[model samples]
Target: MSQTAPIRVGRIGYLNVLPIYHPIEAGEVAGPLSVVSGPPAELNRLARAGELDVTACSSIEYAMAAKDYLLLPRLAIGSRGHVKSVLLLSRHPVARLDGKAVRVSFQTHTSVALLRLFLERRVGIAPRYESGDVTRALQGGERPDAFLAIGDEALRLADHPDYPHRWDLGSVWLDWTGLPFIFGVWIARRQAAVAAPQAVAEAARALVAAKDWSAGRPEVVARLAAGQGGFSEQAMRAYFEGLVFDFGPREQEGLAVFFAMLAEAGHIETAPRLEFLDI
Candidate 1:
C-alpha cells in the first residue's frame, strides 16, 4: 500500500451506523479514508477477500476469521435490551415455527447466526432457512412463515400488519443471557495494521471522535438519519437511544459468551481469542 493512498474503509450502508459515519462523511472528523459502502454481509465478504483495510463488520464474521483481523477497541454496534431493529417477523408464534420455512435477508450474517442460536438452542426448534430479499418478497405478497429483517428495513417493517408476531433478536438475546448483544465491531486487517499502522490508528481515532461528537448531539444525528429510514426524528432518536456503541468490559463479556455458545453449538470450530489493534 502506498503511503499516500487513502485507507480503504468499509462502511455498512445502514442508518444504524450513520452516527459514526455521518460525521466523517460530513467532514467533522478528518482522516485519510476511502469509504466503501455496503451491507454487513457484503462488507464481511470484502474483509474476507482482503479488499477492506478497516471495517465495521459483523461480530460473528470477525470471530469466524479472527486470525486475519484485529478489533478496534471501544467501538461497537450493540444493544443492552430491545434493539428495535434486527427483528424476526413471523406469521405464527416462534415456538410453533418448527419445520417452517424462514426467509433470511441476504444482508446479514451475525443476525442469522444469532437467530439460529435462539431458535435451535433456546426454543428447541429447527426452521428451514433460505436466503431472499424479505422486503421485495413481502411487497410481492410472498410470505414464508417468518423472515429476518435488519437495519433500516427492520425499522420500516416493525409494525407491518402482515407480521403480527415480531421478535426483536437483540432483546431476546439479552433476556436469555443477561448481557448486551454486539451486532458489529470495528476491525482492521492484521496485514493492513502492520503495513500501515499510522493510517489504521488515524482511522480508529477518527471513528472514536465521530462517535463522541454524535453522542453529544442526538437530535442532530436523528434528523440526519430519519430521512433515510422514513422515520420521524423522534423515532430515530429513540432508536439511537436504545443502541449501545461503546465496546467496554460488559460488551466484551457479552461477545465472549456469544462466541462460546457458537462454538459449543458447532457453528464455529472454537471461540477465537479477542485480539485488538493497539491504536
Candidate 2:
C-alpha cells in the first residue's frame, strides 16, 4: 500500500477502544497505515509529538490540541449513564472523605478531568489529588482513601466487594449536565491531513465503518476483543453495550457541554471549535 505509505495510527490499548481498533489491527480493513497501541495518555503524547497521524485520544487531549489537529468525524467513545468502566473507588463514601487525598489513574485524562469537575461542582468536596500507581494499586500496595480508575481495571473494581463505595463517573456527569459523557474522540494532526488528505479521509471512513461492523455483529467483536483484552467474552460484550461508537447530534451536545465545563473550570481560555476531516 505504497500509495499511503508512512501513515501512522495510534490505537488505545484498553478494552473500550477495541471495537474501533480491531478492524485496523487485524487487517480486516485495508489501509496504508501502521498501528501502534498504547494507553490514552501515551497515545496523546505520541500524537502531540507527531509520531502518530491519527488516533482515538482522550477528549481532553483533543480539546488541548484542537488548534493543531482536526477531529475524525463520527467516531468517539462515550456513554450515557452508568459507565462501569470509569469509577471512583473509595473505602468510604466520597462525601465523607472531604480532607482525604484522592489517587487517580494515569491512563486516561478525560475521566480524571470529569472526576474533578464532578467532585468540585456537583458533589462539593475538594480533596487533595495525586496520581495513583496503577501497578501498585492493582497489587494491593500503598493505598489512598479514594482513587479514580478507568478502563478494564475499573470494570473489575466495580464488582469487587472490598471497594464498598463506588461512583460511575459517566453517571455523575449525566446527573450533573443531563448529557452523555464522551471520553475519547478520534483525531488526526493537521499536517497529516494536509500531506495525505486521501489517506486521512480513507482512515476516517474505515473507522466509521468499523463501528457499523461491530454493531451488526457484536458477538464476533466481543469474542475477538475478549481474546485481545484478556477479559471474559461476556464481560467484553457488556462493556461494548455501554460504549457509544458513533458521533451524532446528541454526542455533539455532550462534547459542547464538556468543553464548556472545562472552560468554566479554568482549564482552557476558550472552548475549541469542533472541526472534522472531510469525508
Candidate 3:
C-alpha cells in the first residue's frame, strides 16, 4: 500500500509451497506485482524488515512475529498425515534416539522445533546438533544417530531401501495428538493490513485461487517444478491430491494444537491467538 513503490511480496521457494505461490506465477502479467521467492527463514526476515508485504513462512514465525504481523486466511502448508516433505531419518532405532547427535537440515526451524519437542517428551532424547547435507546426516558422522530433513530433501529419501528409517513428522504428530500439523502459513505486516487491506486480500485471494488452478493441471504443475525441489510429475500430483491447502476449521484446529504443543514444550513464552484475514 505504500504508494511510493510497488508492493513486494515474498513466497517460499519450495515444492510444498507451489500451490500458495502459483498465483504469483499466474499473475506475472495481469496481477502487476513484484514477487520474490526464497527459503522460509529468509522470507520471514524480509517480512520483519518491511521488505515484503506478504509471505508464506513457518507458522511458528508468524506466531512469534515481531509485534506487527497478521495471519492471512484460507491458505497454509499443512498435512494431516504422511507429509512427505518433513521426515526424521535415523541410523538407530526410533526408541533409542536418546542423547544422540542429530543434524537438522537448515531452513527447517519449525519442523525441527516440533520434532525436538516430540523427541524430548516422548523418546526422552536430548539431541545434539550437526548441520549439513541430508545424505551426510544419514551417514551418522561423528555422533549422528539421526537427522531431521524437511521439504524437498526429506521427500527424496522417503523410500531408500538402504535406510528403512524414515518417520513422517506430520503422521507422527497426528498419531500422538490426533490433530493435524500446520507447517506454514501466509502473513502480512500490520501496517500493510491497515494501509492496504485490499492488497493483502488480493495476495491471499491469489494464493487461494492458485490452489484451484494447481489442482486441475497436474502435468502443468509438475512441469513448473524444477531444479532439485523434490518435485516430479508423480510427486506433485500425489502431494496436491493428498495434502489439503485450504485454511478452514480443520487447519485452525491444527494451528491450535501446534500452539499447544509448543506451549507444553516451553518453546514459546506465550501462545498467541490467531485471527484469519478475510482475503
Per-prediction tally of clashes:
0, 0, 0
In candidate 1, which residue pairs get closer than 3 Å at backbone N, Cα or C atoms, i.e. clash? none
Q: Tens digit of lDDT per residue, candidate 1, span 14-62?
A: 9999999999999999988899999998999999899999999999998
Candidate 2 local lDDT, 1-279, one digit each (tens): 233585788888888877786776677766666789899999999999988988889999988878889988889888998888899988898898787888888787898888888888788988888886754765876556888888877766676666789898888888877888889999989988888888888877888877776788899888987887678999888878988877888888999889988999997677798898887
lDDT of each: 0.93, 0.83, 0.74
lDDT of 3 by residue, 86-179 (tens): 8887777877777677778677668978888778886777777767776764566443567787777777777765556878888888888787
Taking all chains together, each candidate's TM-score versus the true structure is 0.98, 0.95, 0.89
Clashing pairs in 3: none
By TM-score, who's the top model here? 1
When sorted by lDDT, best at the front, the candidate numbers are 1, 2, 3
Report the candidate with higher lDDT, 2 versus 3: 2
